[model samples]
Target: MVDYKLELIILPVSDVAAAKAFYDKLDWRLDVDIQGEGGFRAVHYTPTGSHASIIISNGLTDAAPGSTRGTYLVVDDIEVARADIASRGIEITEVFHEAQGGIPSVNKEGRTPGLAPERASYFSFAIFSDPEGNEFILQEITTRLPGRV
Candidate 1:
């Protein structure tokens, strides 16, 4: 048997410096920034308490800038997290929840204003984007689903 862990996500950006600055404003930890020969460069960032990391670099991926979407960041409290981030000067969408009989989506197909009724975990979310328009979703999850941990 073997164990595998998700490690890194590569984000394509037109300007590495702008992307780096955006993540810095979010207060995510900047793990590393390195420049290599032949004009190679990579800037790594990790959200607080996250096991995985994201790398914004040149030539590591072929995806276009702002193509990344629906990347979810789990939080214990969506409101608090949203407020904290909004205070950081980032524009985030108001907290929204999946309506009954509706699946969660990056689009606002079945989303309702404010938090989920009674504040259920994994049902509420807020959205924001980086300078490159890379979309990120912040989801509330106080308790993990079975086998998630």
Candidate 2:
């Protein structure tokens, strides 16, 4: 065994302070705050009762601001999540579907399930970019039609 359950996810940001503020508005609690290395410090925070955590670190290399990657969040209520996030003064982009063809089934090669596209359905979601230009998506799986997986 690896002897480890999940650890942490570190994201590089141009401005640690601004990144911290953005996450703060999301109601995330800070776990670690270390800025003693002449602004080379990093901040750690976690979403309650989750094994995953986000760590915003000062650029240790050539990485620049808004260089972070995308993150997807599956929420119970997309609208509520959008409203709450927007109310925090965070900029939210438009919400739409990615045009998934349909739910995935057995793979062609039987190796793995590569892509399972989502089509039009009762529920909807949206996508938005963080201050650092990191794309994030909010999705809601509301209803499961009969005989549809």
Give TM-scores for every candidate, taking all chains together and pairing residue i with residue i.
Answer: 0.92, 0.68
Query: What's the lDDT for all of these models?
Result: 0.86, 0.63
Task: Give one digit per residue, the lDDT tens place, for model 2 in 1-149.
Answer: 56566577667787888888888888877899887656687889886445678788874545665665546566666667778788888887444443434322123232222212352343355656657776666656556569743
Clashing residue pairs in candidate 1 (N, C-alpha, C atoms within 3 angstroms): none
The stretch of ten residues in a row with the least summed lDDT in candidate 1 is 100-109
Name the regions of candidate 1 deviating beyond 4 angstroms: 37-39, 101-103
Q: Write the per-residue lDDT of candidate 1 for residues 40-81, one digit (tens) a residue.
A: 788999989999999988768889988898888999999999
The lDDT, on a scale of 0 to 1, for candidate 2 is 0.63
As a whole number from 0 to 100, the lDDT of residue 97 in candidate 2 is 43
